[model samples]
Target: MADMSALTEAEAANRLMRLAKLIAHHNARYHAEDAPEISDAEYDALVRENSALEAAFPHLVRADSPNRQVGASVETSPLAKVAHEKRMMSLDNAFDDAEVEEFVARVRRYLALPADAPVAMTAEDKIDGLSLSIRYENRVLKQAATRGDGQVGEDVTANVRHIADIPQSLRDDAPDLFEVRGEVYMAKADFVALNARLMVAGQALAESKNEAFDPETVRQFANPRNAAAGSLRQKDAAVTASRPLRFLAHGWGAHSALPADTQMGVMQAIGRWGFPLSEHLRRFENAAELLAHYRGIEALRADMPYDIDGVVYKVDRLDWQERLGFVAKAPRWAIAHKFPAERAQTDLVAIDIQVGRTGKLTPVGRLTPVTVGGVVVSNVTLHNADEIARLGVRPGDRVVVQRAGDVIPQVVENLTREEPRNAFVFPDHCPACGSEAVREEGEVDVRCTGGLICPAQRFERLRHFVSRGALDIEGLGEKTIQEFLDLGWIDEPADIFRLSQHRDELVGRKGWQEKSVDGLLESIRAKTSPDAARLLFGLGIRHVGAVTARDLLKRHTTLPALRALAEDIIALRAATEPLPDEPPHRFQARIDKAIADHIGVENVGAAVGHALADFFHEPHNVQAWEDLLNEVSPPDYKVDVRESAVSGQTIVFTGKLETMSRDEAKAQAEALGAKAAGSVSAKTDLIVAGPGAGSKLKKAAELGIRVIDEAEWAEIVRGG
Candidate 1:
């Protein structure tokens, strides 16, 4: 990891902004959507980075900082809303036994109890599932709600009533007015069976409709936790009724009466009252016994019927819990001991190079089928060639594959130390298109130069073209593209423009209606000539990102002019005589000279030039180009700058913008013809400093650059 101290104020500010957005996005995907994209450890690393930066630059903290936020976006469900009487707070986690000991000691210290005093705690399996608060009045289950942003939740009372474990009417021993806080989860066996059943049903229905089945669309839960959440939140009670979901009472919500004093006693009381309780729940007198129970559960995690991410330990006595109440988002009295990721040894059968939409090659480890964390693992990501090299793993060797939070398997270590029969050789040619796979300068991953020629890149490339960041054809998403591609109605990017040609054909498809079909075609027609920058970005060029594409388009105006210039520069460089003793550095210098001398496009470099040249020169990609252009004629790029105070000047923005995103701010500056530099330097004509602006403000003062607030920035843009 790089040092945060070494980061400039501008860099830190930008990083803080990016971290805020990334963490928020992952939070949404993990909490509200029941679909997490990254592992828990990976997510933790991001949080740690954000924390480190914030600690070093406290003045730069934004209003949307993840440190202050609890859950992701509040999930707005189709079901009725239910406000939690007592907030369903999450537990602060302890990864190791030392942290567990500290938690116990913290409790003891807070209560001023002696270290030798028996601070009892109940250790129970941490069931990974959606949190539910079931409120009962007069021993009758009144409502059940999901933990939506802690304060309010989606009411699933009708749906939860169908679950056998969650009794509609509690037993006589149940408290008069109390809520049963528990996890609504799917058993491991049930999750597998549900997926299998859905897959079989999907295939039969697809066959009946004379179409292919997509098992993913039918049941795409990555784990039992996701499955449980998805199943429990169904709007239709009948849908929830069909699935197997079970609940285990753990604690309480707002209560009028108590059946027992200790935490274990309350849980036992709930269990006797017909609500299911975790069978692993046990009371321990000290930290060692609690951790011992945690370790025992960790060993049994893989073999359990359902997934258990860790063990939870709460101070057993109710009085102790009251004294050591809640902290920020979690209970200070309760701490969860998270188990490390599950791992299993599997034989590596082969290394497969899979090409992505952008033509980047990824190595996948084909492993002999093994089960870890109750899920079957047949393949793992080697990550890259570097990973393969680092692991020294080869085909026919045994490797340890780990499954953490993600369903995707990863190679952790190679167990077999013996040499391979034959050394594993990474192919230099793309298997998808037989193109020269080149590892570009300063890039770790190797990529196929085939571009649109590669079969692997075709569909994905088009999908990227119409994506929100690109042409943004509103109704045409990935699924629609897939449907079009499958029916041979659309193959190339140009085919999207001609979708109206097959409007009748599209409308006939089961899910495609006349209104939707027409709407989709209208969106395609509206994007016949997308903004030059977006079009260039959608091309999936090797090194051309959206920002670079904008920079290039701002300079070249049109795709043809840019292509002509790029090719001419490459040809001009080819003709230029190389230095007598040409090394790699000299070669780079020669190309740099060609770009600087022959082509004076402001920010064009060797890598961008090479990518553009290679893209235009490829025959199949050229064919794709002609086909696309023949359908939709593109206009020249034009930035009509209205005379403004900020126009045609170099501007630097620091800290949080009050009204717009950083990207939008940069785009606005560019539209009015200002160079939005990332740093504050002597060349800067203007600096827009927002609240929490730190080092950049000082730098602007030192350089004597005019600094203005975000309001002033708006005024300048408004031609005030």
Candidate 2:
């Protein structure tokens, strides 16, 4: 660790700020989606560093600090509907046996119980699957939901009914109102079979086309947990049923009455109620027994039918749990003991630069295939140019690769050899389109300037166009787009609208069914009058995300008007190039003035302004715009479209928004031309306070900010 004593105040403040951003990103990925990019252990380390930095620089704590946040609002899920009666909180973790002992001691200290007191705990395998809560009323399944942001969850009643392990009905003796919480998983054996089946299907299509199948085109799961998550979340119940999934009950949620006073008793009762219970739930007398059981589970984790990352130890006595309560997002009465990260040694054969849709170039290290944690990893990301310099990694070097706490494989260290070798040279141009690659000031990543022309950029852009946040065309996922590109049937976003013209050609193709093709055509047809903001976002404009697009379109309502403004910009630029109207220097000065006047949106500044102007001036981009405009007649949106309390007001939402998601709330605000600022300041006009309002709430009170409760906020939006 860096010497904390040696660091300057400014340096400490900067580190704390960086840590806040890093931790918040990982927290959202882990808590909200259950699809964490980094391992749980790695995430914990980041949090630790953030805490240490904050301890040193207490005054530098950000309003959006990681400590203040919980799981992100689950409102993004289409299935989200039912509000959880009791918050489905997560468990705190213990890194080692010493921490486990410390946890027990802390619990005793909190309760003021003596060391000699009989303290029993229940230790069970921590299944690495999505957490699900099934509500039972009158001994019948009422609803099933995923733990989305702990407050509200996605309703998956229809999908859960298909899982064999999830009981449809409970015994008559069960509580009148009860909620059973468990992990929904796919067995290792079934996961292998499913992947095998997918491989066969993929191969059959390739053979018919007389070409080799690319694994990239296949929507295979990265791990068993991911497979289970993706399977259970399918829009079609039949699709979920076809996939192998199982559920193992380990806990309870929102129960009307307890059958027993201990954790083991509840598990036994849940098993009797017809839901399959976890086999590893056992009562232990003290911390020694707890650690033994944990170690035993860690040893047998590889042989288990399903994936498990750790063991959970909860206070056996029901009264202790009530007394212990919660700390932050986790329960104080329980702690999860996770396995250490896994590592493997591999040879770095080659490093290739991949250009993403946004033009950011990522270095992918191709390695001699090696297995780490039973998964074969052939490639690892060196992250960027900075990572390359940090590690001094070169091709043909021996590297220590690990997936211990990361979803993506990473090369952590380079084992340099004694043999003489030249230093590696990074590329100066895009490998795909040969465009000049340049890194912006203060940015680590280098990007290609080639927009629509780069092959990689074209493929990714089209994929993003059909994504849920964009056009949201159903049945047109990445794999289908890849197949179309391979067959030379579609190349651009405009070509997507022209798909129906190839109905005859698509018929009887290897993987295309008449029903699927017709479904895709129907989806495309439905998007003819796509939302202006969504269409703009779908265009893959540089520096224009969904929110920025909405904000820009709110200012300049229609594509035609936006195009007109761009034309004026082009005219100004043209005037500088020996035009008859004015002197060159005077024309250049006019162009600068025109750009500054036209770009007046709240958050958009010079950088965004220039990106939009340059994008519109490009010939190919203009042609594509014209073609797409003809294909899908996007509607014109008024700047102050929604006449509501939120319109024309700078709003800041603090704490948990129970009514709608953060995304939904922000979208509603922007729909009315109100800018949603991240932090509250003197400029903030309104603050919507929800439950658990902390620093932001205190700040609002100090400033005498106009504050509205969630109920009041909901009522206003309802009227609009």
Candidate 3:
């Protein structure tokens, strides 16, 4: 973990913002799609880092902080959403005995009990499965839902009925309006069998089609948790019935009447009401007993029928629990003591370089199959060239592979580093296109300069182009893009617009029907007059992000004008020369200032200018750009400016906007016909300063620019 002490407030705020986005992406993948790219340990590490930073700089906490969220949204789910009567909250985690002890101590302290007072708690294995809430009305099953963003969830009542472990009707003595909350899980054996069946089915279908079976094309669950989630959340109840799944009740919500005064007693009542309870669930008088039980469960983990990543401890006393209450996203009365990532020794068979969409080369280490926690690990990310060098890893070395957070396997140490014969040489050329790859100064990644020419980069770039943040053409997903790319129907951004020409051929294909093909083509045609900023951002130019693209387009108005400016800047840079008396640094600074002035846009600096110039400098890029423009003519960029007091004024927003995001503040400014600049300068007419304004606030005062608090800015916005 990086030192929070070393980070400036601005840098911390920026990191918190990025962490918020990164965590949200992973949450959507895990919770919504049932597909996780990183391990549980990796995700936990990120959360911990975010928490640490937030703790150090509490004011820097973002509105979208992971700490404030429970699960991903279910808006995109096919199933109807059920608004949870009571929120399905998550639990705080503890990794060590010390933390566990502290949790018990904290609970006791919150309850105002003496240090020696016994705080009996219930301890049970935290099942790694999809969280489910099954509501019962008048002893009959009413509705079942998958936890989605805590407050809302996808209705899976029809699907849960297929799981035999979940009782359709509770006992006669059960609460009339009780919500039994538990995990709907797949057993390890069932998960393995299901994956095997899927593989065989995939191969059989391939054979029927008279095509070679490709193992990579077969969809298989990454883990039992994912398998359970994907199986139980199916849109079709018949599909859920076909899969073997089980449920174990841990708690309840929205109960009409109390069944017991203590946690263990209530769990017993729930078990008596025909719900499967954890066999290992036990009550402990103190933290010591709880820790002992946790260890016992950890020992039994591998032998268990299903996956469990941790043990959860909840205060047994019901009234005390009520007094303890909840925090932002978790109960203060309970904590989950997570197990450390499992590790094993494996032979590093080979290291392969894979190029990402951005042309960066990532080294992946292939390993001899070894089970770290129960899942077999064969491949691990070496991260980058620097990581490989740091670990002194090479092909044919024995390495320690850990299933960190038990999701993604990674190489932690090269055991045979001292016994290595020759150090592996990192490749300097793109493996897919044989293009020159170079590591830029101050960057750890070695990237292929081939850009769109590289096959890997080309495929990824097309996928990104149709991504939600880009042109976002409906029906153009990863599989469709790859299929089209393979069929030679598309190669560049321009080729996407030309896809309508292949309508007949597409409809004749196996999966593509006439309606679907036409719909896809229509979606492509819709982008003929694409937003200029989106089009520019979709080009995958270096150092030019969506915001920067918008800033540039706002100044230039049109794509042709932007290109013309880039060319002029390139010519000006080429014409400039350093004087003999001028230092190299001074000359470089002068050149940068000239470029910045030439662009005349705040935040779009020398780096962006140079990137644009370099992109247009390439003949192939220019040709592609012209070809794309020929296929689709984007309209001149425009912002719907409204008349307001700040009309035509350049306003800079500084520090934290308590009720709104920085982006939101900027958008508000744009709507009010104000130009939002990034920095406070002589050109800046006003500064909207919030808490922790820092250097920008000082600069605004120094420049004698009129500054107003966020409330005052809000009032101005209201007046506008």
Q: Which candidate tops lDDT? A: 3
On lDDT, the stronger of 2 and 3 is: 3
Q: Where does candidate 3 have its weakest 10-residue lDDT segment?
A: 9-18
- Assess the local accuracy of residue 222 in candidate 3 as a C-alpha lDDT between 0 and 100: 72
How does each model score on lDDT?
A: 0.78, 0.78, 0.85
Model 2 has an lDDT value of 0.78
lDDT of 1 by residue, 50-124 (tens): 878878977566545666566654544567888889988877667788988998987876676788898999989
Candidate 1 clashes: the total is 1
- What TM-score should be assigned to candidate 3? 0.69
What are the per-model numbers of colliding residue pairs?
1, 1, 1
Root-mean-square deviation per candidate: 11.6, 10.3, 8.7
Poorly placed runs, candidate 1 (over 4 Å): 1-89, 105-120, 137-139, 148-155, 170-178, 186-236, 242-244, 253-273, 283-286, 296-306, 315-331, 353-361, 404-406, 421-474, 482-514, 521-720
| lDDT: the better of candidates 1 and 3 | 3
Models sorted by TM-score, best on top: 3, 2, 1
Clashing pairs in 2: 39-405
Misplaced by over 4 Å in model 2 are 1-41, 55-59, 67-80, 114-119, 203-219, 354-362, 384-386, 426-720
**For model 3, how does the per-residue alpha-carbon lDDT over 1-720 read when each residue is reduced to its tens digit?**
878887554446446655676688789888988866667777888899999998997744544568879999897788999999999999889989999999988776665678999989999999988999999999899999999999999999999999999998989899789999999999989988999999999999999999999999998877788788888888889999999999999999888997899999999999999898999999989989999999999899889998999999999999877756676688878899999887899899999999988898989888898887767778887878988999999899999887654355777788999993899889999998999999974356799999988999999989888876679899999999989998998999999999988888898798988888988988988889999999998888876666667878878999999999889889988999999899865676677678878988854556667778988999999999999999988898997765679998999988877766565677678668787888777999999888888999788778899999989998998899
| Distance from true location, Cα of 181 in model 1, Å | 2.2
